[model samples]
Target: MPETSGVPALAVEAPGMEPHPAMKRRAALGLALGALATPALAQAPWPNRPIRLIAPDAPGNGNDITARLLAPQFEAMLGQPMVVDNRPGAGGRIGVEAAWRAAPDGYTFLIGNAGSNGINAAIYKDLPYDLVTGFRPISMLVAGPNVLVVNRSTFPVSDVASLVTMLKARGDGYAYGSGGVGSSAHMSMELFRQRAGFVALHIPYRGTPALAQGLITGDAPVAIVNLVNVMPFIRRGEIAALAVTSLTRWPELPEVPTLDESDYPGFETMAWNGLLAPLGTPEPIVARMHETVQKIATNPMIADRVKLLGGQLVASTPDEFAARIAADVAKWRDVAQRGDIRAE
Candidate 1:
């Protein structure tokens, strides 16, 4: 009666008709919990979907091969599919630019190599992206010897010395075929000729397939090419592996000596592949991928396949790969300048 206060007090509190104060508090807590859970359910982990690996070449090319080799292992470790996206053109510039432009999300990556990233950096002028700074160096996948090869039945060469002797005698009369003017194949031949003190007329072709055809048909008798490219023909007794350009002998071709051990001591070159991501990828993702690749780099199945296909497994860390890229660029720059090698 003191203050009925126009507010219905006891009459509004019908038994079980209104929620208790404690119950009200509990109800509010439930709403808050649901709001929090919604976000957690909406956002999954970094690799919620298939991760894409862009290979800067055709399906059968080196970068593509490296990507496929990594895919299964990546899937096993990451619990997500790793798909290779082949984007082949413009000496790898097109594919590289694609990777560069991709978002810095952990899902996008590139399968780069000594030629696509290293040699192209040194040779191509005014590139759209910075090769070294624009990418996060992951690790080197595999590296193998670039061998000096000749048509077995057509050329009178068996070893490094014999090839050199033949090259010196033939002089400019000897013609060699390379994929193109500034291709690694062409650079390898130029390096070989300069170091061995000989000259061979260069016959540029559309690509390695054409170059291989030229070698087989005796259109060009000698070529410095990757051992893996001509592996099948070598086994068929059509092409002979004279000397490898790596510092050490390739395991599959153990009988063949390295250029560093032959008369061209200190001579070394290799076809290398590595993984890279767009700059600004999270550190945790980078570390995770590096650790996974390191663990599986020595997988027997991958090792056996690489060996049989003529490759060497190189599981180098990010720092090592970065240093190698820098050094490789410098080496190729010197080679290009000395040999007048430039991309048209």
Candidate 2:
């Protein structure tokens, strides 16, 4: 260590001059310090300061909720505050690009969701970034099923079978509402309709709360929406939950039959969120964070809270999450094409 120059400062050497002994030590320290200051402009180990986790949606949306749920667990494990930065706009392109543009240090990560990481890749003609290649998949943090809901005052259907019967009988005459055309909710309902051999008018609302309100006010006769968005309405009997889209029944709504059990076998869809690192993030940090997330998912308190939010903890391997994202993109692409659904 150089005592005269207390900070890590570089010592420039002339071509013909041999530097003094003190200059040599300071130069060695400075070069090492320069190497260590790649991301945060500091010469400490990874994450000596707070970490930023980007959630690519407006506050209170699905991504935001999941961000809050996992941030504390990350903080506990990493010995730093994991802050949630919401950069919502342009159908999530804003936040995604924001995260992608960040340095690939251990200090920044993204809460990548189905929309930003799945459907957008499928539906958009040209996206600014690539989900498969632009970011490093860390782990799938949580997965939640969308509920098939019908307004109590407007719809007479009580169960999936009855709903299927009416829709099949009416053919493509029914109407359904969702958050937006390319949203997870919209594609989920489209998947259900395809399996049930029916189609409907898709009325797009601005957001989840608006869509839920639309469902209750008879804006659309039936809608498949996020469980978290409509739980209060369902509790008040404003709407009926015909089925959930998980493979098995959701623990939170045990009475609600799964679409798989409702005769659409193997029917499963989730509004999933996962962790992602910038493309060039160090592999050691990615591995350590991946292991940390697996522990967080299995923690009893975190597990209970996820269940309470109507989500299942799925800390999938990086390869597995990447594969799942690819599968989702392909499935949504087919749905969008077959249904002639266009982004708005």
Candidate 3:
């Protein structure tokens, strides 16, 4: 059998510990009895107990909602109850740390996204876990673009080009809202600001809802928010989407042009969610979980639900997910450095 770092292999006796003649006889009998019991123990299957999935964001947020949507499918496929534990705080650092510290067993997993896994990795200097080494990628579940929306009553700009012209004219006089300092929303807008040669004051809010409220109340006339969270308001005519951050247009907002298509070429940033296990989890368990999740993510029924929630299904392989995470970490690290972004 293969040896894991922390798990000990079954052994009849310790090395260099010889027994006396009488003791040796008893030990032989014990060994024979133990050998008889080993097969049944080894045959026990994985996931005999409930599994825990940690979502490092508040409930109703994209990550949390994704976790809830997939939990039942995972439970049915794995024959174990999958529980979502919400640990929302410190810009997703709290739950990510908790998941990292968990034992390298299949029972515990994390549902993390660009904020927790990508942006935070760039901004947090003394993070407890290494984003690339502390966790094993399971699969990339979904991806959603960010929309640049302005208050219909407050901002006069109509499209990406006009919005850039206005921001350049106004300079730092105009402000924008984001979920937090190091969130994807903040970084996306910062990327835009850097490329467009414009500046806008950043107003940090506690959550996406608060950021949306800031835009609606004209506290911050503009915001780059997740498409899922802001689409409803745009439909209601309370806000107008000027552009999407992805290289291609979002299907939900087909009328809005992409930043790459409008003026800035090759601009593509998105909020994504994926599954990960503590580093050193057994390979067999990881493979099984990945297969199960991929199936669930690709199902037509699940795809329909994801579309309704304004997410595009990715269902990427473990290696693909790992590569994407690395690229995103590097991308955001550069953005944070150039923007001097730090956690509040």
TM-score of each: 0.85, 0.85, 0.88
**Between candidates 1 and 3, which one is better according to TM-score?**
3
Which candidate ranks first by lDDT, i.e. highest?
3
What candidate 2 gets wrong by more than 4 Å, as runs, is 1-44
Candidate 2 lDDT over 1-344, as tens digits, reads 46465455555677998888987897788877666667555445766799999999998988999899889888988899999999998788889999989999888999989888988987787787887788999999988889999987766878888877777787557789888879989999998888788868888889888898888888887988888788878888999999998888888888999999889998888888899999999998999999999899779988888777778898899999999888988888898898887775
TM-score of model number 3: 0.88
Q: Write the per-residue lDDT of candidate 1 for residues 1-344, one digit (tens) a residue.
A: 35363322332356768767876776677677767887997566867899999999899888888788879999998999998999999888889999999998899999898788888877798898878777999999888878888886667766788778877786456889988777788888888888788878999988888999998988888998887788888778787888889888777778888888888888988888898999999888999899988888769888888887688677888999999888888888888889877788
The predicted structure with the larger lDDT, 1 or 3, is: 3
List the candidate numbers ranked by lDDT, top first.
Answer: 3, 2, 1
Worst 10 residues of 1 by lDDT: 3-12
